[model samples]
Target: MEYLSNWAKNIVYYILFVKLISHLIPSGNMSKYIKLFTGVILIIVVMEPILSLPNMEQKIKSNILNMENIIAHKDFQSQSKTYSKVNDQLAINLYKKQVEEHIRKLVRGEDVEVSSINIKINEEEGKNFGEVVSIDMKVRKKNSSNDLSIEKIKIGADSTAYNITAEDIIIVKNIKIALRGFYNISPDNMNISVSQ
Candidate 1:
């Protein structure tokens, strides 16, 4: 608006002012100097609006701030999602560990060491929950017990089932039974294995 006002006034006075100045000037050697000075002043007046425009530095700074805010917001969302996934996995792992520890605690007589326990879980409708599909373990007897051995006991129709002792598998089956009873899980859906 300021530049527009200045421009309007300049144009309105341009012809009248130039004519008046021309008439008053001593029409001699001095006229050239006066004409030259007036021309220079006219040029300055026309260019003032362009010179007063906003600088590029301020625009660049504003753009940079906007870009920074966008990046920060995106990074925060990505990190939050990653953290949630990790937390869910951690919860599942802790549950599996607790189950293994509980089974280890239940074994009676002749030191029983449980190596590892795994449970398969499933997710549905934005909610996650699953039953133990199968369990595998490495069992070893710490002391020389002459009365009891794992291989002699029978488990199933499969000949390989006997390859791994019955005692170790029976202990695991008991653990599974306890789990099924406690959690109310169907036995048909679960597979239990114990090896020495």
Candidate 2:
């Protein structure tokens, strides 16, 4: 728009200059030549603005390209943030599933049916195994012979299912000793429960 206004101003200036020169020239063939020369100058004045367009276009194009680059960078950053959140959630879910699987293996080859496993994790600490806050397990047996339910309740005995009893426990001097270990927390910080 500025270029257009400048072009108009240049045209007005050239017209005034040509008019002033016309008055100074004498009436003869030389005057005709002067008039013709002024006409050529008028043509040059009209075309000057149009000829300088490529340089102006280059600057405008450069600004447009810069804006596009900025928009692309911002879009990438937004996508990365979204993906990071999704990835974190997926990691937590996968870890929980793995823990459930490990508990199932603890039952070994038996008739016990695991109902559900609920574990509450600390989101602030991320999905690290040490960040586990609590775990609740529900399980039952199909039959007495294929189960260790009654043995688990026996007054002074460790029970077995499928001839299996895997542990490091010792009940001596009326002080029941069990080795229950977990990461990222002290013994007092962990909460665990199992029910049949």
Candidate 3:
């Protein structure tokens, strides 16, 4: 091929030039150093074709861009996963608060004051995720004196007396039943306490 012939001619011309230079210079330490420098130049000339191969620059640039894109994509995926976890946690917290408020309302309907309510739900991802796991509630009966009713005079022996403990048990049972029916939670998972 014409290209191969030109390359061979170039090599021949470089060798002739080096030989002429060496002949003009006397054999000495300086001559060896010059030969070494010329040898390095000869290597560069010999590798010129391969080094200057077509699309080499484009290939290098493309490889760099591909690496950059891969890194960027990995970073984006990591960020998205982090954001998703945070969002899921936020949603879970909001749901817990809403369920607590609903429980408070249900307890209030029984003429009880809710001191605290904690509803635990499944946070893991699965079919049972977000299901209520347990509930802990602390409540107290509302003050009856606020009713402003007149005291009745006892004309005879009382047939029945009010028991606060019994009332509290009834309130707790009612709360458990309400929660079980509405939220499908088991009474075993509920810890309800009525405090004086």
The residue-by-residue lDDT of candidate 1 on 1-196, one tens digit each, is 7758977788667767878888887689988897898788778778766665565457778999999999999999999999989887888788777766765665433355656555555533243364454555455555555675334655568755565565665666676677677556566655555444
Write the number of the candidate with greater TM-score, choosing between 1 and 2.
1
Which stretches in model 2 have alpha-carbon errors above 4 Å? 1-20, 27-51, 107-111, 125-130, 146-180, 183-196
Q: List the residue pairs that clash in candidate 1.
A: 150-165, 150-166, 151-165
Looking at model 1, which ten-residue stretch has the lowest summed lDDT? 123-132
**What local lDDT score does residue 98 receive in model 3, on the 0 to 100 scale?**
90
- Local error of candidate 3 at residue 178 (angstroms): 0.6
Model 3 clash tally, residue pairs? 0
Going through the candidates in the order shown, the clash numbers are 3, 0, 0
TM-score of 2: 0.54
- Give the 10-residue window scoring lowest on summed lDDT in candidate 3: 148-157
Candidate 1 TM-score, true structure as reference: 0.61
Candidate 3 per-residue lDDT, tens place, 76-102, comes to 999999999999999999999998888
RMSD of each: 4.8, 8.8, 9.2
Candidate ranking under TM-score, highest first, comes to 3, 1, 2
